[model samples]
Target: MKVVIQRVKEGKVKVNGETVGKIEKGIVVLVGFEKGDIPSFLEKMADKIVNLRIFEDSEGKMNLSLKDIKGELLLVPNFTLAADCKKGRRPSFQSSENPEIAKNMFDKFVEICRKQIPVETGIFGAEMEVYILNDGPVTFILDSRELFQGGLS
Candidate 1:
């Protein structure tokens, strides 16, 4: 699984010109399911995201977690994150999970997040227009395999 996490002041998603989900003063998370993604890491990913110290504290240091600020979350499925662009000019989607499997995994990820905070979501596999007011313009890309493999300190 791959996720692009953005610290945002606010975010929203619209489908068919109708607002579907929105959040304020929190994070906008774009998630993608890659082939061979482990489902067990879904919960771990949720825990990591909610507790990630990407928010600033009084000392102007990144020391606060989303739960500390009672922040919301906006989750959106973005399978394009798995696009393979190393070869031809056109990206390849062979690394992405099948839509049927990915939709279930996306739902599971969202359910896990909703348990931790107020959660909003873009419809899985829908044509969504996402709007974000990024806070600190802070962002991070998370991969479950990397996290489990101790790729970061």
Candidate 2:
């Protein structure tokens, strides 16, 4: 599993002219599930994302976590995060999780995030049009494998 976390002032997702999910001030998280995702993997990613201290603090230093700033999250499933584009013009998705597995892990991840802050989400596996107003342009990538191995500090 992998996640790209973007701190945003506002974000929204639309599909076919219908609004699916939106957030006011929070992180826009793009999640990617690789093969071998499991319950433990989902839990680890959830834990890691919520605790990331990418938000700024007093004196304008990046020292506040999502939990500290009381932020929201717009989570989207992005299988392309796993794309391998090292050697070819076309990227390879050999590391992406299958639909069944990915959907399961994605659902679990949403459930966990929703339990914390005001969480918005895009339709899992859907082609979504996302509009984001990035703030501070602060972004971080979380790897489920690394989190699972206790490297999240």
Predicted candidate 2 versus true structure: per-residue lDDT over 1-153, tens digit per residue: 888889999999999889999988889999887777667776667777788778888978888888899988899988999888998799999888898888888888899887877788999878899988999777788777776675445
Model 1 score (lDDT): 0.93
What is the Cα-based lDDT of residue 51 in candidate 2?
A: 80
TM-score of each: 0.96, 0.93
Give the per-residue Cα lDDT of candidate 2 at 19.
Answer: 90
Candidate 1 lDDT, 1-68, residue by residue in tens: 89999999999999999999999999999999999997887888999999999999999899999999
Highest TM-score against the true fold, candidate:
1
CA lDDT scores, all candidates in order: 0.93, 0.84
Report the alpha-carbon TM-score of model 1 versus the true structure.
Answer: 0.96
